[model samples]
Target: AGGRVLLVEDEMSILKFTARMFQKHGFQVHTTAMNGLEGLEMMNRNIYVAVFTDINMPVMDGFECVRRFRDWENESEERRSLRGGRQFVCAVTANAGPQGDRDRALRTGLMDAFVAKPAKIMDLVAMARRSAEDTLGHSNGN
Candidate 1:
C-alpha cells in the first residue's frame, strides 16, 4: 500500500501493531487518539487515502468521526466531490457480536467496510490497499 493512511485507535498496543504493519508494507501512516474530535481535526488538516478506525473510542467515537467526515464531504462546495479527498473508513474492532452494530455503522455514511478483532484476518491490509486503489480510480476518472 503505497498510499497514505489515517489510523484512529484508542488502544495503544493495537495502534502500535497496526501502524507497524502498515509501515512495513510501504504505507505512509498517520495515527491519532481514539477521540473523535481529535480525529476530525486531523482529517481536516491532512489528506489521506484511507482511514482505519476502531468503533469504540473515548471522548469521540468512531461512528461520530465517520459522520463528521461524511457530512463535511456532502456539504463541501467543491463541484467535483471526488477531488474533496476520499477515504475508505473501516471499523477494526471486536464488537461484531450484534447485527445492529454493523447496521448502525453502515448507516453512519462514513465507513466503507468492517473487520473483526483479535484481527485474525491478516489480509485486511490487502483489502485496505485494494480499497485505496479503488478510491483513487473513482476519484481520478478511471
Candidate 2:
C-alpha cells in the first residue's frame, strides 16, 4: 500500500476510473467526493498525500475548494497537527483554453499541478508516484 489520495469529481466515470487507477497502483486508500464542499469535509476529517480535483463541479467548485483548503491549512492548528503540513493539490480540468487558465491556477498557489482533461492514465499514475515520493522526501526533511 502506498499513500492516501482523494478524488473530487462530478463525472462518475472519471471519478471511478481515477480511483481504480490509484487503487491498482497500490494506494492505501482512495476517497472521493462529488463536489468541493464534500471534498473539503473529507479533507478536514482525514489525511491524504494528494488530492485530484475537477475544476467544475455543481456544488462548490474546485477553485473555492482550493481556497478553503488553503485557508484551513493556514488557520487551523488542529488540522495541521493531523496532516503535518499541506497536502499536494492537483487541478483536473477540461478547460485547457488558454495558457492563462493554467497560469491563473498556478498563481492561486493552491494547486501544485494541473492536468488537462482527457489525460492519459499513465500520466496520472506517474504524477501520483512523484507526489508520493515528494511527500515522503519532505517528511524526512530532504
Candidate 3:
C-alpha cells in the first residue's frame, strides 16, 4: 500500500473520480472533504502524506484552510508529531484566470505544488509519489 492522502473538493464528481484514481494507484487510505472547514477538521484528526485542495469553495476556502493548517502545525508539537513532519499541500483549482491565481496560491507559502483542474492522471500519481517520498525523507531526518 502507498501513502494516505486527503482530497478537499467541492465538486462531488471530481472528488469521487480523484479519490478512485488515488485508490487505483495503490494509496492505502484516501479521504475526501467537501469544503475547507471539513478538510481542516479531517486534517487535524488524521495524518495524510499529501492534501489536495480546491482554491475556491463555500464556507472556508483553500487559502484559509492552508493557513490554518500551517498555524496548527507550527503551534502544536503534538499535531506535528502526528504527521511525523510537514505534509505536502497541493492546490487543485479550475481557476487559471489572468490574475495568476496559481502563483498567488503558491506565494502564500502553504502549498507545495499546484494542479489545474482536468488534471492528468499521471500528474496526480506523480504528485502522490513525490509527496510520500518527501514525507518519508523528512521523517528520516534527511
Per-candidate TM equals: 0.85, 0.87, 0.90
| Candidate 2, 1-142: lDDT as tens digits | 6688889999998888878888998875455599999998887777777788888898899989889988988888866554346778888899867765466798788898898888787777777788888777766777
- Give lDDT tens digits, candidate 1, residues 1-142: 4688778888888888888888888888786555777788787666666777888888888888878877886676562366435556777778877675577776665678877777743566786678777767777788
Q: Summing lDDT over every window of 10 consecutive residues in candidate 1, give the lowest-scoring window.
A: 77-86
Candidate 3 per-residue lDDT, tens place, 1-142, comes to 6688899989998888888888998985455589999999888778887889998988999999989988998888876764465768889888866676598886778888888887886797798898788777767777
Q: Which regions of candidate 1 fall more than 4 Å away from where they truly are?
A: 83-85
Best by TM-score: 3
* Whole-structure CA lDDT of model 1: 0.74
lDDT for position 59 in model 1: 87
Better-scoring candidate (TM-score), 2 or 3: 3
| Best-first order by TM-score | 3, 2, 1
**What local lDDT does model 1 show for residue 9?**
89
Q: In each prediction, how many residue pairs overlap at the backbone (N, C-alpha, C within less than 3 A)? A: 1, 0, 0
Least accurate stretch of 10 residues (summed lDDT) in model 2? 78-87
Give each model's whole-structure lDDT. 0.74, 0.81, 0.83
Clashing residue pairs for model 1: 36-60
